[model samples]
Target: MSRIHKFVKDLAETRKTPKEIKTMVDTAFEVNSISQSQIYRISALVMAGRTLQTRRARTEKEGPYRRLY
Candidate 1:
């Protein structure tokens, strides 16, 4: 991942207010964009995200399934 991505991902794994999160993005990108609002929205989603562990999709539709299978 890019440094920026890694930093955001790490932040997402923990807790932070909008101000601190904004500071992080500012330090990494060091520039403003027309899509600045979108960036903030994405950052908020990432910040409230679950564990960074990768998840795979399952096609089966069975009940009480277990990965042990």
Candidate 2:
């Protein structure tokens, strides 16, 4: 699974709050070299039940396989 998907799934399984998720995401970005925008998009996907492909297409112009948030 994608990092975003894994992060969201973990958050859901752990019942993390948005604030907590945001903090975790921020830390993850700093450590993993991921973009903040991607993280935000991923969070949106998790919350809205949107497909990752759609979000990726909207967020980037390159391969959808790349990590998004």
Specify the highest-lDDT model's number.
2
Model 1 Cα RMSD, 1 decimal: 8.4
Error of 2 at 46 (Å): 1.0
- Residues 1-69, candidate 2: write the lDDT tens digits: 667557755674466665676678667765644454555555666678766677656668665556634
Clashes of 1: 0
Q: What are the models' TM-scores? A: 0.39, 0.41
Off by over 4 Å in 2: 3-5, 12-19, 25-30, 53-69
Q: What would you estimate as the lDDT of candidate 1?
A: 0.51
In the order shown, the candidates' Cα RMSDs to the true structure are 8.4, 6.4
What alpha-carbon RMSD in Å does predicted model 2 have with respect to the real structure? Answer: 6.4
